[model samples]
Target: MIRFEGIHKSYPVHGREVVALHPLDLTIQAGEVFGIVGHSGAGKSTLLRLINGLETPSGGTLTVDGQALGTLDGDGLRRLRRRVGMIFQHFNLLSARTVLDNIAFPLRLAGVSKAQARARAQDLLVRVGLEAHRDKYPAQLSGGQKQRVGVARALATEPKILLCDEATSALDPQTTASVLQLLDGINRELGLTIVLITHEMDVVRRVCDRVAVLDAGHLVESGPVAEVFLHPQHPTTRRFVAESEAIDEGALQEDIAHVAGRLLRLTFTGEDTWQPLLGRVARETGIDYTILAGRIDRIKRLPYGQLTLAVTGAQSDEALRRFAQAGVHVEELSR
Candidate 1:
């Protein structure tokens, strides 16, 4: 587990102290895929770097797996790094080395013999499905293949925590999905605690169990992915979700301006998403509804559906009550 108690960071820029992170408290539970999401310069990278002692906090305490970071000496920090592996957005492979050699580099640094390091590298190459590219150099491989090699190299140290610093931002959408699937598989199989930082909410929706939203160095919001994604409370978070879903709230409101009925936004999750409750309720209560906008998608492993509807008839209030009773989240929207 990783715990941050009023942790904050600052840097000396142009002869003055500049705050990069505000004092905040957060906890990332063990074996869960946690995401730190924000726009550029929002301190996402700063927070991730603090977990492995790459950046020391200016205030408060940071503990990883019960070990305090501030007390660690040079050797202790080295030991901590051995247990925390990091992959970069740009594949930071050794230019002159083969994929096999690159993966074995970390082990060699840790005093493992050449034969033993290569042997471990061989196992990682197979795990990342890069066995065929083992002898190839970074320049000779495709972007996805290079990242696979990066994953293998980061795993070479057998770290308990994997830090992905925008690991998929450099890839195409198809390749991004492929790499995310690989990360998800690794998490499930090895129970590794993965913390990834990205600007994309779609990435969080696909893999993160929980997420923290950062804006202007402040920790604005944090919660389970399903909860935060579906119902955002902060402006920064809402903007990210809107961008991810390609939603134009102003346009949507304008589109519904002329519609005549009570506006409602209904949210359904899990098995409720599969239920035909809308039609059944309409029939029973004689309420008519027109879907103004709707979306059905999966957040991590849970399937969810959200719809904006123009509901009418004298039974509208009863229909809303029935929806709430059936475990559906009903929010009234205004024009």
Candidate 2:
């Protein structure tokens, strides 16, 4: 587990201290995949480094597994880093080293005997499904395979935590999905605590249990991925959510300008998604509704749907009431 209490970071820029991260109070639960999402310069990458002590904080404290990072000496910090592994955006691998030796590098650095390290690395190769590529250099492998090697190397130490700094950002969409699935498997099997920073909301939706939205160094929103994705509160959070859903607010508004009736956005999750709520409500309330835009999707296995609809006639108000009574979140939109 990791906890940050009023933690903030700064650096000197032209002899003036510029804040890179705002005061943060967050707790990443044990064995859960936590994600920090933000655009470039939003401080998410800085937050990830802060977790493993790659970046020192200017104020407050960060504790990982009961060890206060600020209190650690150089040797203490090195020891603690062995318990936390990190993977990078570019698949940081020694170009000259074969996949086998690259994976064994971390273990060797930890004072593991060459033979033992090679054996452990060989086993990780199998675990990450890169056994066939063990003898190949980084240059010979595909992007996905290269990232797998990076993952294998990160796991060489068998750390309790894994820090992924845009580990899949460089990969294509399909490759990203495969790599994320691998991470999900690692979390489920080994129960490793994963802290990843990414600009892609799909990454969080696919694997993260909880997520925090950062903007201009501020923690704009933090909560279960499903909640934040469904009902984003902050402006930055909303933009991220909208971008993920590919919803162009301006375009949608223009498209609906001529539409009649009261516009409402309905959100439903889990079993509610399977129920014939729309048909049932329409029948019961005698309300005619038109779905303007919507989609059914999953948020880390939780089924959910958000439908932008138009409702007309007298029963529209009662229909909205029934939707609320059935636990569907409704938000009114302009005509």
Whole-model Cα lDDT of every candidate shown, in order? 0.95, 0.93
For residues 120-162, what per-residue lDDT tens digits would candidate 1 score against the true structure?
Answer: 9999999999898889889999899999999989999999999
* Cα RMSD, each candidate: 0.9, 1.0
lDDT of 1: 0.95
- Which runs in model 2 stand beyond 4 Å of their true positions? none
Best lDDT among the predictions, by candidate number: 1
Candidate 2 has which clashing residue pairs, if any? none
**Measured by TM-score, how close is model 2 to the native structure?**
0.98
lDDT (Cα, 0-100) at 78 in candidate 2: 93
User: Each prediction's TM-score against the native?
Assistant: 0.98, 0.98
**Model 2 scores what on Cα lDDT?**
0.93
lDDT of 2 at 238: 89
